[model samples]
Target: MESYKKTNKPRILNIVPISIGSGEVSLGPLYISSALKKAGFDSVVFFPDLSLIMHFPIKYDFIQHQLDYIMKQIRPEVVTFSVLSTNYNLSKSWAEYIKTNFNTTHIIFGGIHSMIEGENIIKLDYVDAVCLGEGEFSLPQYLELILNNKLTQENSLNITYKLKGKIINSKKEQVFLSLDEYPFPDREPLKYYYREGVLDSANFITGRGCPYNCFYCNAAMLNQNKGYLRFRSPGNVIDEIIEVKAKFELKKVIFSDETFTMNKNNLFKLLELYKSKVNLPFECQTRVEAINDDIAKELTNSGCESITLGIESGNEYIREKYLNRKMKNDQIIKAFHILKKYNIRTNSFNMIGLPGDTEKTIWEGIDLNIKAKVDSAACTIFMPFKKTPIFEWYQDKKLIIAEPNTNYYENIVIKHPNLSKLSLFFYSLNFNTLIKLESNKFKRMFKVFLWVKLFFLLFKGFLLKLIKNPLKLIAMNTFMKNYYGRLSVKGIIE
Candidate 1:
């Protein structure tokens, strides 16, 4: 709240751009910062340890220590908190604390949860506004308008403004048209606190939104509505890689799009462009439906080192009836076979317990992973996210967040009634241990000196993990991204 005292000039802060959960950076605020800079306003994004502050079941008084330091030291006019699902309450509390302590700044909130749960959040005492949808474009304009004393816009897409304690009903905007319009991330402005490593080059996103909405999963985590599908042009995408390569001196990339190869033609074209221009290896997350012999070969030829498929369940009944994945076991086998045939590694993402998943179904999943011959497999305990179709289904079934003591994680895991909590958790952990011991890289590498091909392949195996074994995999990647491996724009080069 120390930054907004002046009504004439502009200052800005963006938070949660780097979600502590996965050590992932959200490009939303960075793009907004670029647009604000272009518009002649001083802007920068902030990456704080929200989890360090939130500190679920293992809460400590020290959680607020870092937040206290930020409030006392940093001075900015407008601060925006990117609120994810469980972060809303914690961030809102922080915003309120800032408002009460320092009156010079205005606090705002935005992100998927902010949009989906806009009304409840704005009802909070400290939140001045909620950027209801894509905030990158709308935020800059809103800030510019506020600075110019024209803070009332009725038709701007995706913003919920509060005027004098009354909420304004402004219309939302369409999803971004061109993903290529945004600027590249500059580590200098962020004070150089980022993940950079062999895996750091592994942390770039070329697109936003997903086309398909699977139940039992939070589709709204990326973007809601029919507008989740938006990607950059091949040239634009290659240019981003070149920017990172030239700036960070990296030789590989990780395409973090939900369905990295969702558009068949677009994937091929982008691969060809990368081969001709960047000549770097990369991996991506895709669905079983997108893989075929031709598509898999093109991916390999274009330097795709590996791919991860979200095989949520091996049981056909659960896939369609519960998760809405709608894929057949034959297609799943075919996809993994193609990846293996091309000598490109593969990862299978399996869910241990879901709404209708029986213990046998979960075992079928483990068996499915083995039969598919995936290079790696990840297992995750399903959580009922707020706005997913299945989330609502659970709520209707009167299965809300019953245990206030429960964190987003659990030593024992189960999403629904079929599998008991303790049983689910043990099975998930056991499956993970087996996958690790049986993993291709684990069985073949470490004792070998195949550092060349081993580098990318081994890294791919690790990248496809973490979703399941969060304690080890997530922590390792987080450290690898930031303090552990410091590529420094030099180490990534040959």
Candidate 2:
């Protein structure tokens, strides 16, 4: 283990663990790394691309070698991991491994998972600290104290740490009122590792925090004490986009906010600026209740290429009573119609196997997507997160089939009387198929063709599993070539 004396600047390594099926480059680590660099610290973002290492033995070895190499070479004073709920166990394992190998390095966990599970996470032997809400402000200050040997177990702002076998939580930190104060996220490190060509899009956030209280989400938990939502000025947001466009020559931008159309005034102002100054096509996600004719027109005029709306469940009872969405079916249908009228692509996000969901309700969801005529629709099985109200409800009812895991796409983790695991699996496949069928202009022929494709896809998956060694080698080669090749040509205007 390397020892560090007091130094002017300490090297910090920001690591993002790439879980299977999650390919997007997150902005949390990037923003935190940029903040640290601005405060005179040597910080670099490292993404161990494990997008393809779920079940492959050889790729597992490859990932271990890469982690060992980074720790040996970088020898960072502090190692931070940005984790999601699905990847919490994996992150914990990595933290344990790093502590065993590099005992001197301090370990900090920050992200959605750590924010909600702070008390339990801080008790872990390998974890030294957990940043509760936001890391941009808390992390730099915490690091400075460590460098100057001034850090104590006493309460600090927005940080929780352990000392003398007791956990000490800091005073609550205020949320940043102005988003313009922070520098643009450091994409230089992302450019080296992120597979930009996979989506051909760069992501930016116009704001932090959400005001809505969706039952299944953790946003309400984040806003419980800090009861405010903040947005960047329109001019400031455009300035960052201009800088990013010049640096990356990007084709598309993704406004990855909780709801991009939250503030009508701010949305219109930003749209006007984006129309005149940065005329690049962009996509965003918002709630169904937020869309209107005026908003839809402004979005289209500003080169909005696509829009995704969260129509979580089609059954009004399920949406309002269980999900707390408060959106009616008529509003969702109207929203989709408005987007279609403007010739903008529409995608609907739905969920199946929810707590109150039955076979009838699940089909209703599919029916709504079909009637909406969405260009694309995505359906994910509901996984009750730890801190959400729904998780507690399920626990009390003894409906939870197993602990939360990373398999949200293919597996069902809950046991509902009306919904079996096998039924849910087939429903997921059929839900997707129904959407594709509805999206097709030639519905009759394409429906038949799609079924054929689905059959072949299932057969191929089975064969791949049966011939494990040979198929695994082929799949690994293909994944590597596609991943690296796309990354090489990323951020280039076609």
Candidate 3:
């Protein structure tokens, strides 16, 4: 690592999103990693084994080799753990293993999961600090402050020091709003993780947070109750997309933002910019309320060949009353029609058995999803996450059940007092199988291939166990669901 400011530059290492699909992603840590490097810190990245889903039943010994490779070659003075979802445990283990072997290396954990669960995470022996909320703005200045203070006797860095069993969360400053300011994601660098079989996938985040705070999600409250919906200028976004394509050989750039077409002016400008600069295929996740005829056509012209949408429930009552989603039933139908008119491959997400969910509502969702005839449909059971409206809903009703097992967290089926666990599971499974798979994308593109591959992979691993030991799977998923008495089974489709 090169020297900077007469002090040994902090050898910072970032762990990117470890999901088992595509290399060269630019979500949270990857963006922050780019920022840290631009700020002249010696930073390298390590992305753990990517799976289509979060986990597979395999003991990970290769992670040690990768960690050792980073430690020995880069010799980072500070090692940061980027924890997303339950993947924190894997990062925690690596952090502990690294620190155990080398006591001098400092460890800090950052990401949505850590930020929300910091109170629990900081107690672990390996972790030193948790960067709350966004880190591109917080991390750069945080490094400088800690270096100047040099609290050698203190136990923590960046965040409020945890001492004498008293803990404090770092006062978060501001989230970086300027997408132009962020360095182009290191596409070629990240491709090293899985370069050859790379499926020409690129993910870009144009905005953060959601406008409607739903009962089942965390992204809404992830902003700490600040008004939702923040975005970047069109010029900055276009530049980044072009940069990603040129450097990474990207065939499709997916805008992984919550609502890609929220602001009419910015979205139109972005669509125009994308049309002018690149003729690459792309996809995005959006709400039905946001996409009208004009916007759908604009998106299509800009090479939007595929899109994924969240149609949580077909029951209008659940959508409006329970989910905080304000879209009208006709609007959703109209939105699908517009996409279909544009000849775009559409994937609408559906959920079944939300609270007050009768068999009628589940059938409604199935009917709607089947009627839409989207390119694909994704489904999952609702899980109560901390800091969300739904979490409190469960807590208030005294319906909160604690499940010590990790498998339950996957939320395949809603656990409710009114619905038997087996009933919920079978309802979801049958509904999923009902969505007729046309395999249209196989003829049009290969997304269907990936989809099919992921389907079999799930059944091979988790589903296999569920088939053999249905009770175990139900127990695990139900416990992790954290459903209140007669918890509703809400679903998202993006």
Most lDDT-accurate candidate: 2
- What is the per-residue lDDT of model 3 for residues 363-457, given as tens digits with 9 covering 90 to 100? 67766776776666666555566666766766676655642112332334235656665556655544454455322223436545645753564
Please state the error at residue 328 of candidate 1 in Å: 1.0
Q: What's the CA error at residue 207 for candidate 3, in Å?
A: 2.1
TM-score of candidate 1 against the unseen true structure: 0.78
The list of candidate 1 runs beyond 4 A from truth reads 1-9, 17-23, 49-63, 153-157, 173-175, 185-199, 220-228, 402-415, 435-494
Model 3 bad stretches (over 4 Å): 1-9, 17-26, 49-75, 89-101, 145-158, 163-177, 222-228, 397-414, 426-430, 437-494
lDDT (CA) for every model shown? 0.66, 0.77, 0.65
User: Model 1, range 1-494, lDDT digits (tens) per residue?
Assistant: 12223233476767662233333455556666777677666665655543443344334345566566565555667788877765655676678877887776778788777877788778777788888777667777787776666776464647778876678767554665577777665443432332323124535676777767687655445545555567788888787778667666555678877688778877888888889988888878888887788888898898889788988888989789878888888888888988999999998777765777886687678767877887777676676667778777777877554421123434332246776565555455445444433333332334244334433543454554455556655444443353113223433322
Q: How many clashing pairs per prediction, in order?
A: 10, 1, 12
- Tens-digit lDDT string for candidate 2 (328-355): 8888898999999998999888888887
Prediction 3 TM-score vs. true:
0.78
The total of clashing pairs for model 3 equals 12
Root-mean-square deviation per candidate: 10.1, 8.7, 7.9
